[model samples]
Target: MAEQLALRGDEKLLDLGCGNGFIIEELLPHMPAGSFVGLDVAPGILQSARKRLDGADIQAEWVEGSADELGRFQDSSFDRAIALYMMHYVDDIDQALAEAARVLRPGGLFILGTDHPDSLGEMHEVHFKALRQMNDVPSALFKSSPKNRISLTNGQEQLQRHFRNVRTHAWKDELLFPSTGAFLDFYQSHNHCSASSIPGLDLGEGFFEELRCRVGHQVNQIITQKGHFKVTKHTGLIICD
Candidate 1:
């Protein structure tokens, strides 16, 4: 967004669907006083965001709302808007794009950062492999965006349909771990109480222990064969007017 907007300290910026307000923290420092705002539906995440500031007088607004549907705010109220890692969850991509356009000034830009649509393809391959081991065939949840969900391919069109000069810039990174232990913390970053490798299911102590044993056995075989397993993750950006 900083690249697309060429942001300055005085610009009024909005972080749409600013989950956990991580971007807000990074942005607030560079922005001029009283120039930044954040919008998200998750109030708890917003509250956690407040704690990140340590009660320092912040020059930003936090709105508990959905970017997919901006209820208030007059047209052309902001200089720049950001939709980061969020377009994949909206219910109405077109409506969200229009609403975002509605809140942005004539020359303003809406920068979107999302999971690469193809990321799902890669995930499906890995997840289905794991599921098959557990004898659980993949379903709609793994195929497409489920109920109350969205996708990057559709999101690209939605942005172009409502705004002029829409351009997508790709940003990708492949995550590789030498050992599962390197990514266990990354995996734990999921929403609390959300299980991993086992879904709609629980792997009790014995279950995890057996998994550890089995995986360990596999790792030993790899060591003997001089091989390592690699996992990959990808993300990208879409800039629109």
Candidate 2:
């Protein structure tokens, strides 16, 4: 991401949906003479980001605002803009992109980090199989990754609406889970095995318990057959200018 930004150490950068400032922290070293504005809708998250960069000797500001509304920043104020892994949560994806384009300088680059629709195919495969085996499951629960809203597959077209040039840099890697517990932890952290994605499902703890057990069983079987259960990550960056 930093390489795509091509920071000259003095450019003003804007990070839309900058969560906890982890990306900002990593990129700050490249922008020693630069300033950053981290914007997000959650005040709690903004506070967390401020705390995370408390001692860093960098010019950084945290703003509590939505990505679609960049009224706080003036036009052509940023040399680089980024919406990393958080564009899927934007209420209005087009508006957010427009706002980003408006705020960026003429030659500014916007890097959007997102995953392919089938990024974690193994995880989804095991999860759907478990859901199918279970009784009385909500159909809405059988949905694709939320990132599909702005994924590598469809992001280029969306970005082309605003930027003259849109390039996709895709790469793949596999995550090997040594045990069922490790895989379960990864699964639960990602929307609780997709249970949390469906609105108003009102499923009880028992449902999640059973779902986890089933998914864990599948992962365990894979681990026993192979040395570990593998989850392929097909993710990429959509760089626009």
Candidate 3:
């Protein structure tokens, strides 16, 4: 995505949802003469971002804020902006886009990176089926929610509302887990695997443990046959002017 931005080392840049400042760290050298602003709602994450930029000769500022409102910045304050892997967390995406358009200079570039809705593909299908065999998965899981959804079509349409010459790029990769237990631990930590979220389901006490055991067994079977449990990771980016 840094390549797509075509940074010339002098454009004012904004990184919306700049978690831990990792992207900035990677792009810092490319834009040595450019200034940067990192905006995020979490202060803890911003603190980590500051540490990442510490001792660098880059001109940068970290702001604690949300994308839906970037009032602290003046109109056309930025020459480029990026939103990476964090749009799903936003409730009012339209408002956020408007804010981006407001802050960006005319013809400025906006690059957004997010998961393709088909991410994890059959891996999640098999996982969900395993959950249903033991007990009902939450009805909410099937319902559309920004927190757990993305679509290339929807993403392009949204970007078009505020940008021109919108184009999409796809990225694919593979994630391998040596053991089912390891995969289970990672998923449970980042996703809604807790039984507490599905109380009305028929699952009884120790529901999470049972669900974990069954799903782990299913994944382990695949690992035994394939040597490792692999997940297809599908991600995409939208670049607009």
Q: What C-alpha lDDT do the candidate models reach, one value each?
A: 0.63, 0.90, 0.81
- Predicted structure with the largest TM-score when compared to the true one: 2
Top lDDT hit: 2
Residue 4 alpha-carbon offset, candidate 2, angstroms: 1.3
Candidate 2's C-alpha runs over 4 A off are 197-199
lDDT of 2 by residue, 1-241 (tens): 7887877899999999998999999998899999999998889988999999999999998988999989878999999999998999898999999999999999999999999988888898999999999999887887666788999989999989999999999999999999999999999999775686566778888999999999999999999999899999999999999
Candidate 3's residue-wise lDDT over 1-241, tens digit each? Answer: 8889988989899999998999999998889899999999999999999998898999989999999889899999999999998887776888898888889998799988887777776566655666678645566555443535435657888888888688999879988999987888766764533334443655545766776677788888999999888878888888888
TM-score of each: 0.78, 0.96, 0.86
- Put down candidate 1 lDDT per residue, 18-137, tens digits, no spaces: 767778777766675647777888899887776776566577677898777786888899988888776656667678888888999988888887765465343344433443454333
Ten contiguous residues minimizing lDDT sum, candidate 3 = 190-199
Clashes of each: 0, 0, 0
Q: What is the lDDT of residue 94 in candidate 2?
A: 93
Ordered by lDDT, highest first, the candidates read 2, 3, 1
Worst 10 residues of 2 by lDDT: 191-200
